[model samples]
Target: MRRIVRTLCSVIFILHGLSVGQVKTGADLLFEKYAHLVEGKRIGLVTNHSALLSNGKHLVDAISESRRARLVALFGPEHGVRGDAPAGKKIIDARDEKTGVPVYSLYGQINKPTPEMLKDVDVLLFDILDVGVRFYTFESTMSLAMEAAAEMGIPYIVLDRPNPIRGTWVEGFIRLDSLRSFVGLYPIPVAHGLTMGELATMINNEGWLKNGVRADLKVVKMEGWKRTMWFDETGVRWVKPSPNIAGLATAVVYPGTCFFEGTNVSEGRGTDRPFETIGAPFVAGEQLARELQSYGLPGVVFEPIKFTPRDIPGAASNPKHKSIECGGVFVKVVDRNVYEPVRTGIAMLSALKKLYPNDFQWRNSIDRLSGTPMVRLRIDAGEKPENIVAAWKVELAGFGKLREKYLLY
Candidate 1:
């Protein structure tokens, strides 16, 4: 009886130890261990609705209710502070009802905070959940805010979070300097595998900020996060970073399917499964699926699917092919570990162009979306997807080496 009791106690102790090893976001660490950094300082937080604590409280509410820190102002990114605004919609400045603090819009008349906007701010804090894609726009917002913080002579702090996709897998072409836009700013690859904190560090150290200005940046890193762990594996609750990115599965295929946005095709917008479903009015679902499957793309499968686009208020209000039934393939990633998003997108484009030579057309946005005209040019010239993907190997290799200095986890 004594031996059995001792064995039971040991098992309980081991179970508790395992639970303690779960990943904690930088926001969790901020309050638990780094409260002194913000204590007594007037803070201006650049964040959206996705910033939440492990306890499931929004960051805005936590900061407003905190006695140690004074939340003097709030800055919102592309989406409004609450993350309700749709893509490309201009957000207007207003006062936050809950905190009764002034909320400045960074997405409207300006993409960066003016010096006047930061005159009352002593420190700037950034805490938004970002899906690790170059075209996602959050990084651009973060970089622009960092520039503003630098000009204002205020310290910028980033409460780091896990890169929803694994941080070890970097792929795709590096954006050309000539084709730089909000979607493909700087010279990073389409699928940059760095967390927001790591990307901020790179932007600062690499002098990517405007006029080569660097912010006094400090990153409160996460605890127990690994480069190989996806968001679901991190034990952090999933908040839709943007309206379309509903779950971890959506994020997995987003890197590849997002390319369709540059074409005449409906990239599964205005539907229940945005990025997972890809089709245009002209596409034959079975044929597209069969073609995609023939490529033997790793860790993914395609199934014939037909969907109709509709206006989703906060997500895709005026998405492509609204109210029209489209035929396309549903991309199901079976194993994210081996799946390559950018390459898969290239393959899909190649197949589409071949199957519908007359109907398939490349929009001008392709150059900006792809970060280079070569992707559009090559596919138009009947180049195989393999050759096109292999063309970027050298540049991608060089970028991999440069990114090593900025990797946090």
Candidate 2:
């Protein structure tokens, strides 16, 4: 009986704690209990537009109104695939106006998946929605489409979700393998709290794919996710997974004001509070909100705002101080269980480099969004953001013991 009414709706939300519609995703248990593992085959999916379900539909319209899998071709990542492309635009390969299918562009100029884009496919789903930062490029477009479905041997799967900032809070700094890139390619931690099916089983058991190939992977997990629930305590509705993560309180201060996108300010991208509105144009907003509210940081609070940046077409077209104005501060959180978004983004980059030391700049893309350069050479030697967050506590305790060997929940 639908697995005993989903195990009594997970034991009445673990003894009457029913927070919202009761979580279930992983494309809602892959059409409820792995629809015979993609029933007749030929899938492809690697989706976008926040891949929903639980009746709201859109897992590419339930695998193009499935009988049981046949969705051949359609990929997109980094906005596109009905997600309203904006951040760094560039997606092209069109078609899918409503299942005309054939839509490629793994964020343009190809980012993997090309054996003739998986020659009519067989199995390779993903399902997006991941603001669990680590330079959020949808987990590097899901580890380069699991190394192109392990070089087209197919069977990749992944549909899991919910790490919307709460997988038991692991924090920043650890990208160092010569600063990998594509935002960060691995050695984990810019808040790497797993859950894209435990980071694709820790990028396929830590070999970190490519030239170590693997992907026969499968991960349809999520059923009342819990590595400390958040995503509004899981009821699964907020859909804005990109185009400026506009909800879940700007995704819990986006891994710390997304390090003001490596600087030159305006991390609030073209207004309407993009990363909770930090600012620039030679800031002042009540003395930078009283110097980030005298750093008593803990679950946030900062105010003095100003705003301006325009061209909001499909959300921030020319961002970073586009039509100017700035002056910043708004951050507000108020206790997301002691909100430590990368220590409030390294104390707002050490209070904007100690109150604008001649208008702070630093932009070599902030060491690939701080995957290292020791957090921009220890914040340019002025250190102390708690000793640069205690020099990465023994590499986040050996990545919490190699992330407890690929946690599934």
Candidate 3:
């Protein structure tokens, strides 16, 4: 966290007083600054449905209609351009329905843009909303795009947006190089605090790109935004970055609960309250909730819940524990500032393990999702969540220092 963020702990940062009214996104300020602008360039855009202006017009449309940039082709991330695909589903190349621009799928066989994909492009524009979780593949897509742009020697511009979970709270483990995967690419913590722009700068400056390469990275900084402001405080309408992440509350609990995806438990994927809730058919919801309540974790409470995950088409195709009523817990964040999402998640796992030693299952993916092998190993050895969290302090603090150099706000 920055000194200003720590100093102003008492002040509730919002889009007032310090800021005029609302957060003006980088796209919002496009017309203001014309230096290296996309007004008359061939641009290959990497964006999704959430890249919209305050007026409710999508950036893709606004860019095309403004006649500013000749959108040569479109690049779809993990969920495709319109956010229609399910998690981990591959997207095929197609043409944009509205603009007739050739759409390239970067989430499937082609993890990065090919030379042919960049042959006709002068620059690549990236604009996507991130929910501030490491496992979310948006940042990985952007990193690959940057690498492609660098290899092709084209300038890369990032249209910045607010980190919905704010930019001051850095938590969880710095991913080990051994655990590298599409879900956990860069060595960032689970709830990394930087926005897209700042992370891009870090990715470039820290030489984290392919073969220690670099990009001509340019980040359009958000105006009237601060490191302390959460999405709700920005007065900007929330857009679901992906299918399951539908609300701010879900995002708040996601950094922790999303680990459930690694196990047989459903992380509320097919429920109306995804990420905020987690369960499996074998869980005793009320008993688990009662056990968690005794922990008295800060800024959060767990409530017993019962739900049957649905196999909703387009949203969740074959959800975990599909169509089965499961005992669960709802993570309600009361004061996000004090909440430790990673710890809460670890505590939840600990409670489950202690309560049902034989019933609870620990899948291998837990180590991958957790970014290190220690978390799972320690939990399996009956180590308390606090002790596990305390063990991560040295590495987490080191990452915090390295992260400070790239912060924009």
Candidate 4:
């Protein structure tokens, strides 16, 4: 027991040391470490606009210009190749005017690459920034692509990226298999604390891929990254991973506030502050803000404000209750380490429901976002926020153990 405790302490100390050092992403080391894999081969990349090297060159242009490698095609996730499309918007198959490589839509009529899409490719590479939430579709896209590649006997490589939420915090309920949607494809926690590379290994090894598909997987890892280091700590520039996630501060609050989407409230959508603000036309902003303060949620503070959502394509294209006057609370993350996003979300949700029992409603969509119908059921059943959170402790603890086998850092 003493040995185990000491080992854990040493690992934590090493992780902290790494936060202060300059880190190089997986793509930065590609030419030096694994040029042999891509050199002279027709490669397919599953990536989006957020992917960037430490030196700030986009991977598509880098690989296209590389004399050693031939860029064959591109596969886009929920967003288009350039990541300009909005959520759930169908992306048309188009040509990359920059590289002239045919861009296939993995998020449209076809969710995975057909045999026709893979015939000319020797290996498929997946590299995208993940915000470390289960509902984010990029990880699902990566797993699906891996399955397709596995079935076709093609090699799949994940160019590891940092989990922008930092890898030290894992929270929320484990998803139920019956509730798997594109939003929640696997039975993982909402705030899963793993990098893309680590998640790829877990999904593949744990048989979470479609039909238990076994991937011929390889992960090219980052240098000097630790699970404890957040995106800002990594010394790499932050690119908006998606249209709504505008900054690292927004990403910090997303895991919890995102649940508002499954309800009648506007989750700061259509506003300049998506995910950081929660509002509804029925809310009393000042009173709600005071109530939130009474909860004394750690690592965050709430301010009552009013805003109207605008119709901006790709950002808040058609947000709930758009253009309606909404009295809401804006969240400011002061200290990420102590802010329990899932718990905060649950507490706020509970308070709102209590405050407006007749006005607040949970849509069926909550099951997919929350991972189970039980969370919503428990909340409506008049359970305390702490108890609702506590119900998942056993499973969350079990998942932490299961996740250990696949961690790279």
Clashes of each: 0, 0, 0, 0
Best by lDDT: 1
lDDT of each: 0.91, 0.84, 0.88, 0.89
Please write out the lDDT profile of model 1 over residues 1-409, one tens digit for every residue.
9999999999998886565346899999999999989999998999999999989999988988999999999999887899999888999999998889899999888989999989999999999998899999889889899999998889999999999998887888999999988887799998889999999999999998888988999999999998888887777888999888999999988888888889999888799999999998999999999998999999999999889999998899888888988999999999888999889999999999999999988888888888889999999999999999999887898999999999887
Best by TM-score: 1
Rank by lDDT, highest first: 1, 4, 3, 2
For lDDT, candidate 1 versus 4, the one ahead is 1
Q: Which stretches of candidate 1 lie over 4 Å from their true place?
A: 1-21
Residue 279, candidate 1: Cα error in Å is 0.3
Give the better candidate number (1 or 2) by lDDT: 1
Query: Residue 283 of model 4: what lDDT?
Result: 97
TM-score of each: 0.95, 0.35, 0.94, 0.94
lDDT of 2 by residue, 236-341 (tens): 8878888888888888888878888888988887778788888888988898778777878787888888888888888888887788787878888988988888
Task: List the RMSD of every prediction in angstroms.
Answer: 2.8, 19.5, 5.8, 6.6
Give a tens-digit lDDT track for model 4, residues 18-109.
65667787887787788988878999999999878877889999999999978999999987778888877988899898999999999988
Candidate 1 at residue 230, lDDT?
Answer: 81
C-alpha lDDT of residue 79 in model 1: 75
In candidate 3, how many Å is residue 36 off? 4.3
Show model 2 residue runs off by greater than 4 Å. 1-71, 81-84, 87-121, 125-137, 140-154, 157-188, 191-215, 218-265, 271-282, 285-308, 312-324, 328-345, 349-384, 400-409
